[model samples]
Target: MKAPAISYWSLQLLLGWINFAMTAPMIYLYLGLPLVMRQQGWSGTAIGLFQLAGLPAVLKFVLAAPVDRWARDTAGYRRWSLVLLVGYAASLVALAGLDIGKTGFTTLFALAMLASLFGTWADAPVNALAIRCLPETERMRAGTIRSAASSLGAVFGGGAMLILHDRVGWSWPFFVLGVGLLLALVGLYLIRPVHLDTIATPKRSEVGVRQWVGYFASAQRRRWVVVLMLYFPFIGTAWVYLKPLLLDQGLPSGQVAVVAGLLGGVVGALGSLLGGYVTYRRGLHYALPGFAMLALVALAALSAALASHASLPLLTACTVLLALAMGASAGLVFGMMMYYTREGLTAVDYGLQSSLFVLTRTVVPMLAGLLLDHFGYLGMLSALMAGMLGIGYWSLRFVRGMGEMPPKMGRVA
Candidate 1:
């Protein structure tokens, strides 16, 4: 019997819910945990080292190999997702049993690291499943959904979790997050698995090293890889440092939190959705160039505002523009990544691109910090603006023929 076709919106919502569930706990670990540790009188060094718990995310490509090797069909991918998500939820529930106030740092850190590892590993199968199930026409919407879900996750994980801890206690936050994850798991179970084309089973000889590295075996793939690395990181680095800039400009900490944390997240989410709609209405050729232009304008405005030490309202406007640019660019870049993923090796290809995406996003901030130290805010902004302009030009030229490329069924080699 033929299964009922799932509507596009239904699939996006389910995928977005899964993304939200996966993201919130990690955000809590990264954002909420540090604040708690600081309040508990933990040393700055210890708290700094706690950030290492997130290192698992950067190794997604390596972690994805097993899923690609084993989960060669939609049903197999769903099973892998269930097992990994169980590990993720179980880790959170376990954390709920540990009292952070009296627990040893090593114990808490180890548990948190395990949670991150499970969450990171689980993302591969989830995304591969999205690629498998989503039609080519709806891929951009899927990216927008991810961006919006991530923003909501940040608010819940970074903001709501901290508030819960403040009003209740440490364990409640963990408990609540675990419950949320399990709810998403229930939702996943309720949705009937949709079978698309089956991936060809790899021969034993083709299952090892070549499968891992085959994503980079072609020139066109390499070009897209460069675009993946460069396109969004410049704007992203600026967004990362925006809060510090506001503080330096004499905005109160409370105001900075509201502006950068809450307001920025909402605006960014809206921007992501809008960008996706535009991309869907026009073509990638039109959407990519338009988004690149928007980013450049935002960067220029931000630079000008910083250079002049503009009024509070003006500064806020500039911040909103930059946030929107960052969000819009992310929407486009994610869709592009999906567009570039190979058919048979969806997991491996998506993992490699995502690894590079995350790696560059991580490293560029350190370099940006150095630039800020050496050249001040104005200089750093100028450097970023120039870099964006250059990269934008190159990306447009490189992707000029992206419309000509097949949206579905990319060649493995």
Candidate 2:
């Protein structure tokens, strides 16, 4: 029998909208902060310095294990989620004032850093909320919907920065964006999901920590761990340094966000929708390499763009392609992340493996930025292409089809 459904209703749609809005300001912050710095007479090094603000996400795994160990009572996931929502909203207000040009950049940067920490903390519980809400069979659908919503959020955030800054104001975007998150907080009340009586919580003893870490050390062949360690970092290659790369090519600030959302988010949504269907129908085999190739092609186009001094039209085409590739790849990677890790132990049993996945995502992308800064865009894109080639090689050794693993433990989620 198929697992239970999340039941499409007002709550889920509201959740989608609110999450998008709550996240919108930061997304703008990431894009706009650098532009603000550049215009403020700051150097690229200073702008790149802001990325260190994301360090909490990389290290949240240490905290994630503790979160996994305790599942709240009464409200279950909702209880913790509400706390995170409040913290996140308040941070949005502080973020509006982060004039990196001012004397207290370190202090403002700390606030920005806190926002990422809270956001990732919120992500852990919300992901659990998804596990509670959707069945395995329909998760691809759920992921597709979630990603599309996120893409829409990106579009809205990006578009606001692009079009509205001229007329409304720079900080004005924060007001609307902050309200978006606040609305999401209200959305939880509307969800009213049946309490997950069978909800998975880590054992509060040594057994829990052992089990959590034990999965990585499993004797299955060590290949799965290798896969996770080796290739996942490469997944972020194309857009890793995209903003800096674009600005270096001379795209205007507002246009950078507008095109990123229009092409990256809107076009990306279409790509994700199509990818979800393919993943649901065919399995990971077709899904992984197909998306990987799309990314590889996008990289080739980017190399050509940079080599040609970033012809505007060529760069625009590159942006859309990269966005679509990333959209589909999001499904491929996360879908695989879910399938490979928890099904054997049971979905709710995801407490251990799930946290590791989250940890890696946070760590890997942070590393991507550093690597991008060192290598320059073209050099990093080339390295990313190499990363894709590695995944392609690894996939050949391990995958049998969707939901099937060749008996070697040689897969990465």
Candidate 3:
């Protein structure tokens, strides 16, 4: 029951806050923008199409080699994180100036995509830093901390911002977000250099995408990669569509933000923190499937509410449960991803896994919009529940096949 050495523990707290900041822009774009645009008479399809702006985040893996390569000689991940934070904050300020009501979709889309690009660049190094800093034993707890940070970010970005926009307008939320990012930038000064030799040291020669992929191509390694790619798509899609579904249920915008955005985010954050503690104590082999099953049960509860045309209050409760499930499951999966990431190439490998994770979260929502058009919210939820069951089944089976490895490999990458 020894705590992580003080140094590694401090690194975890620092990384956790950086993730909170990095998560804000995305939450604002996904949660806030959709609500604002929908209130402005934009169509469901248009709101969903805006998800394309998030494509840069998915493509961030393309930059992973460059980030890792560039950092080798300079200040390491710390430098990359600082540069991207400033750029992302500046982009958020610039975004504030756009009059979305008067602006063309192309222009707004481009700006959002640009902000996301900056955010994505900032995220790669944070992942690398975490992978480099934590020992195998600490990753689950770190994942939970990171997840809690993300949940708080969502509460601010998605919940608080939406309510602010409802009370104020478009520009102030962006201004606040820009200021938050700048404040998070100050935290960079707190991160001291970490030296963990236990992590694999990459030769200067083996630093490219080819080498990164070659490592993943081995028979034993490929299965882990597949697990990363497919694990969270269903729950992710559910999260994206939940806000809109609440709107359709006749919940006031402010109430929806309070229920789904603020209160739900708190529950989700707590769930993530709890998931991390449980995984750390009992091991991921026991925790992963348990979390996945809990997520499925939450989804079932949500689906039933949708089907029954439940009261707004009842729906609100279901939203909280679903958020809790999604947050916990995500924390567990993220911990597993971190555990599996190869040592020296942490950025590239983690980026690749995240790229696939973002791909599903981003793509499925557009399809959900289509389903909503044809079938309504109830139909859409039902379809998502079925997919969640199917995917959860396979993932649980995959968890069983994840045979033992060396201590480092057993952690996953």
Top of the candidates by TM-score: 1
- In order of appearance, the predictions have TM-scores of 0.94, 0.78, 0.86
Candidate 1 residue lDDT tens string, 266-303: 88888888888887777667677678888889989988
Would you list the C-alpha lDDT of every candidate in the order shown? 0.82, 0.62, 0.76
Q: After superposition, how far is residue 159 of candidate 1 from its true place, in Å?
A: 1.1
Candidate 2, run of 10 with poorest lDDT: 404-413
Worst 10 residues of 3 by lDDT: 404-413
Please give the TM-score that candidate 2 achieves against the real structure.
Answer: 0.78
State candidate 3's TM-score.
0.86
> How displaced is residue 1 in candidate 3, in Å?
19
- For 1-413, candidate 3 gives per-residue lDDT tens digits of 33348877777887887888889878899767987888788889888789778777778678777777766422477678788889999888888998878987788888898899989888888777777757776777788888889989988887778778888988999998888788778877775544333344565555666866676676656766655655676777788788778888788877877787778889989989888877666665667677777778888888888778899878878887888788888887787777666656677777887887777776777788899899987777777778777666766666677666424332343
Candidate 2 lDDT over 229-297, as tens digits, reads 444455554565676688888989667766664667788777777888877676666666667777778
Candidate 2 Cα errors over 4 Å, as ranges: 1-15, 38-46, 72-74, 97-103, 158-171, 195-212, 219-235, 242-258, 304-312, 340-379, 401-413
> Model 1: clashing residue pairs?
none
